[model samples]
Target chain A: MKGTLIKTVLIGISLGLIWYTNSHLDIYNLSIVNNIGIFAILALSYNLINGVAGQFSLEPNGFVAIGAYMTAIFIIPMDTKIDMYALMDPAPVILQMQANFPIALLAGGLTSALMAFLLSVPVFRVRGDYLAIVTLGFGFIIRIFAMNSPAYTNGAMGLNDIPEFADFRWIGSITIFTFMVMIHVIYSKYGRAMKAIRDDEDAAVAMGVNTFKVKTYAFMTSAFFEGIGGGLLASFLSTIAPDQFTFLLTFYLLIIIVLGGLGSMTGTLVSAIVIGFGLEWLRFLDDNMNIFGYETGAHPGMRMVVFSILLIITMLFARRGLFGDRELSDILKSKRASKRKDA
Target chain B: MSKGILKIENITMQFGGVTAIDNLSFEVQKKEIYGLIGPNGAGKTTIFNIITGNYHPTKGEIIFGDETITGTKPNLVVQKGIARTFQNIRLFKSMSVLDNILIGFHNQSHYSYLEAIFRLPRYFGQEKKIKAEAMAILDEFDLTSFADHKATDLSYGNQRKVEIARAVATNPSLLLLDEPAAGMNPSETEDLSTIIHKIKQDFDLTILLIEHDMKFVNNMCDLVTVLDYGEKIFDGKPADAIVNEKVITAYLGDFTHA
Candidate 1:
């Protein structure tokens, strides 16, 4: 009952935040708000696998791509199906089918999860950097499949004309839903078992934890949310291509989680928002570096250089990331206890 | 004529060309505190490996409670009422003491992942039950105060205690303590002996212990066996095993030649 109450209140607050931002902010800022919602889902899901589960996965981009393409296929308007497939032939069933935005988004997420399930069977045999290697390979494979499977994915031309059915409200609701489920799972016995596996696999196994099963479950679930996040991005951007879901995109998520402090949920939220906006706002650096209105000339990758410098500074100073495996609620709880003692 | 709860029948564990445990055999009776002792690399741990399903013996079988358990997985072994601590401490370093213990009850947990994710009534109900039960176990081990502390943050003695507490929380009928008193001070070892005795009686558990702490082994174990070079050198009463020439020579090299 308490969990449900807290969840409803959070959803209400998120909805209000989205509505307020939409009405009050300028177009550019509103778009940032949308990016924030999408990034929250992506980063939080990634955190479940990397931070909380301690799996060190680097394949969220592939999962996200699966979701984006699947969702784009469903949400593509009926009239554009022939034109969309003109570059390559879509399946006969795909041409005849049309799903609502919500169903399409759900299918997109499930597709990513399905792929994760298959990938996990082999990947679970390896741990540490080996797991990362296999997962990275999995991501590359997905992207390559998207590139070559022109009959389905339109090759490199990518999917356009995707319906923008989801707005700020939809994103907010999904974010809240995703956050609530992940939080509950984190606090449960299932989550504890995952953490135990993370801390020491042998110990966890001796303690009766099915480490392989738990690891696979965590990876698959994380992939599910990554897919949803990518689906949302597709609708928000009204376009997506194979190039958009690269290893660099995975690196961007890693930065968010690292800056947020790996296992901390609120930290992920804060860092995702901070970095998401920072990425867009820093585009001025790429356009033409200006300090006191002195142009240093345009450099296409200058923004990335500055971003890399900031990440280096963060690593040098705050190696454990912002919250260092702790959440804001932990600090609040301590403060409340201290105040009570003083009183 | 009395039977044993566990029977290791001609178990030979060979790794590559080297036979770690060469045709070893032993039996542990129900509710008996049995001790296995040896010098380093005598295949005492190798015997443990065979029992814990870390190795499928090259030949022979392990019969526990009338069931053959020669090649079970570690997780399944725990579910079959067998739990063990490591020779080296292996607590989940990043988790709280409570979580470390709570996870030991993974096989006992009734709620599904779906229920846990949704926080359904069954989830909260099981969580509360497990929490209360874990707290009770912590209190018994004098670990309740450190329940919220990380497993690695505890003192060395407390970490060992936490590992044992976590193992016991699995509700095993047979508990294996692999060098449980390895790094403890005298007082800690003294306390551990008492804890082992108390748990054996209170939980109706049979214990198989591997310890170099002779005093602790003599005090707590009902039967003691000595192993040297992968072969059972002595098996009898603790007093008899301790006084046996082979057991003595195994620990201290023979001076008769010199």
Candidate 2:
């Protein structure tokens, strides 16, 4: 108990420092940092199922789209004109007063959670690759539905003029809270049950675990956070389009978890920050590069190419991933002992 | 006579015209070590599976403590105070031995997901109490030293002990152990017999076991049932069961040596 408190305090202090720096930094750097924090939450949400809970689900993008659209519908002033195109009718009288950033984000999360609950009833019945296919289909269905819903979502034209609900301050606070909550959960008895189910379903059932119920609970909880992440992304950009929530986004989240290691919360945290910011940094290579005597000016698909190479390398050499199921505290403890020996 | 805790009547389990347990009927009394002994392919394990709710009886009624448990989910059967260990050791390979036992306490633990998330007072209280209880159970089997090790890393005898530890952790009124001494040295088999007796006394449990070891069965069981070709040939006291002509014939094939 004391150890947990000390850990929580240290995390609170570190988060406070990051929030202060982000708020005071230059605009360009602030945007990058903010995005890194937001994506960290998104990737961590994905990790709840893929890493900790041991179910490979490819529906982060679907939940994100739900969050984004819900946030837009709730927060974006319906009366606001978008490029001379009046997107939605004027805000309802009740909503005009109730439309706040936090409330909208909460609604987004709740909406996604409800969707996940409904979807998991059928989807979680299957295992392994079949489960992946079901989740992938869900993402496509969500995107296609968003594309076709012109009245509510503005169709392919997209919803714009959304209020900026997630700046550096909001993302940083929420990310820290989410990360702590995830860590607490993974260390709990419920987390042990989840891993037991993942390791051996039959054995887990014999041990009195209702594997189906555990899987569904994990799925819905993950979807809730993914929804919050989606809302943050939409609020940051002030616009949302169906194309943004694609398989590619889910692919990125998967890469984050793999780079971190499955079933490792600390691994997810480190990988999320590194990959989130690292991808942004690598964008420079896409725009300016010289190959032998030729100038490769910002190759269009450089990010994907670099990511694919990194993934292959990681899989081949470091299959356990960066943290390999160990948390940051575990790494720190091991490092401290080694440093003490060296000293 | 003590009331029967588990009653299975006219149970017939079939697989594509092959009857595994045909018209099987039995009742296990409270606090008795009931042994089910049968030759190879005589369907002893199949009966255990049926009683534990793994396989639905084609036509039978299973009443446990006055409630029908046939065709119930395995986890619900466990929650209803019926626990079992498999013939093959089925410990969660990656989990610590202690955690494996804690998993048996899943239905008993009252902490909610929220309580766990926040590490609430109740969560800590329940966890600490359960951990202590789990350690005590391990201590009973002399498994405290190996509690932190992965269950799969244990030796065959130790693994068997761990499996039993996990089963009894559910605090069940009735326990089913399938071939508890199947592959063990004489010393290990003797130790397992002692542990089984100790556990039944300590937990006040009614145990039903399937074992092929004749010496172990005659020594440990109060009453024994002998099965041949999925048919019960004898059901009586272990001494009587050993002397029954049908059981001797089933065991020694003609009973000339017996």
Candidate 3:
């Protein structure tokens, strides 16, 4: 209990720092911090399926893209919109409502969730690598469909001039809210069913778990949050494009979950924040660093090569990842006891 | 007239060219311990699997509580008040013991997705009540002490107890336990017998168990059915079934004197 209190205090302090930084910091720093908050939400939301539910999914980027386009359609100013690739006879009636940030985010999430429900009927029966391939195909299909559907998504040129409504405070608060709700669900009875399915599907079925239903619930819920994260990203950047939500984004999210540890919520949270900031921090070295007298800037893909190598090493050495399914509370408890002994 | 809880009529399960269970018929009366004993590969487990909806019998009709539940999904069968444990311990290894039992309470739960997501007052109320019930069930098996521990971290005996406790948490009218005492020591087997008796009396459960432990089966089961090569050799009182020459030969060799 004492350890929990301390951890809560620490989280409060960190959140306070983020709030202060967002309000008082310079524009560039604020933007970087806002991006971090957006990715953090994306990572944590993806963790619901990939981590806590013990399912490998590559569809977060697809859901996020859907959210982004939905948000762009809803939140962008109608008067300022230019006809870059004007496929619509006129803008749809729902897009003219001028919704606020929260409503747009919700719309994005719900839309993505609906898509997930439609897709999961056939996809949930397949397990492991097959499931991953199916989801990856779904993500590609979403991107390709967005590119081809000139009427709805503006085709190849993509939608632009989306209104920027998500500031640092908004994204940060939503991220924290998402984290709290996810943690609660993870500890709840339904969460137990998800873990049971993850651990042993056949055993769970024998125990009377409606495996398909539970899996569908998890997939849709996770997709909803991922969509919201995507909406935030589109709003934050003031743009929506098919290229932004690609297989690379899915790969990065997978790295975040694996680095955090499969089924570890706290691990996902920590890894997201750390890797979000780490990716930004490494940008400084991209232009200047040289390895074995070879200019790194000459090879633009070197960064991802290094990143992929790091992931492979992490997998080989620490197959369970950072926390190995231990929650933050468990880690804090041991730390507190060790601290007391040292003192 | 009190109807039999489960009526298996001419259930035959075929795997490729081999028949695992050939025209097997049985009935489990309510509130009784039905023992199924057979030599290895006699298709005892296959019969259990067929009844539990794990496998669709090539040909058969299974009537549970007057409903034709033949080839129904396992989860639906469980919701119809039939629960089972595996021959091997199949507890959710990563989940806490309490959580493992709580999974059994999934179909019984009334909370909706919204309630669970938002942690509404009704959700909390149901959660608290279920936690208490799970603890009570665990207490019966002396497993309350390990409630917070992962199911896999427990000893083999404790894991077996956890599996049984989880099965009971489903509140099934008919509980099928496959080799519940497969790996227990003598003392553990005795304890399991007592636990099984207490559970049957407390929950009003009709149990059907496939057990190799003759002593445990003899002590707990009132009636026994013997099987040899997917065929029933005897079905009668435990004493009568044990004394049958075919059953003795199936267990040991064909000994003229013994």
Query: Which candidate ranks first by DockQ, i.e. highest?
Result: 1
For B146-250, candidate 1 gives per-residue lDDT tens digits of 887778989999999999999999999999999999989999988888888888888888999898988888888889878888888988888888789988898
Native contacts conserved, per model: 0.91, 0.66, 0.85
Residue B80 shift from truth in candidate 1, angstroms: 0.6
Q: Write the per-residue lDDT of candidate 1 for residues A1-343, one digit (tens) a residue.
A: 7857976887788788878876788877777778888988999999999998898889898999999988888889767977876666787777766788889898999999998898888888766677798889988999999899888888898888888876787887787788877888888888888888878888888888888889888988899999999889898889889999999989999999999988888889889888988889888878866789998888998888998998999899999788877678775875786687699
For candidate 3, lDDT tens digit of each residue in A53-172?
787788898999999998888887666554544765434663464788889899999999999999888888766576688889989999999898876778877888877788887888
**Quick one: ranking by TM-score, best first?**
1, 3, 2
| Candidate DockQ scores, in order | 0.86, 0.64, 0.77
Give the lowest summed-lDDT range of ten residues in model 1 chain A. Answer: A85-94
lDDT per residue for candidate 2 within A1-343, as digits (tens), equals 7987997798789778877886689988888888888788888878888877788789899999999888777776645533313344433442343468898899899999999899888877766666688889999999998887665567787878778768887888888888877887776778778878877777777777888888887888888998999989999998888999999999888898999988777788788888878888888767867779888676777887888999999999999899886677767865886687699
lDDT of 2 by residue, B118-206 (tens): 77898888888889999999999999988867788899999999999999998899999999998999999999999999999999999
State the fraction of real interface contacts model 3 keeps: 0.85
Which DockQ value does candidate 3 get?
0.77
Cand. 2 TM to true fold = 0.92
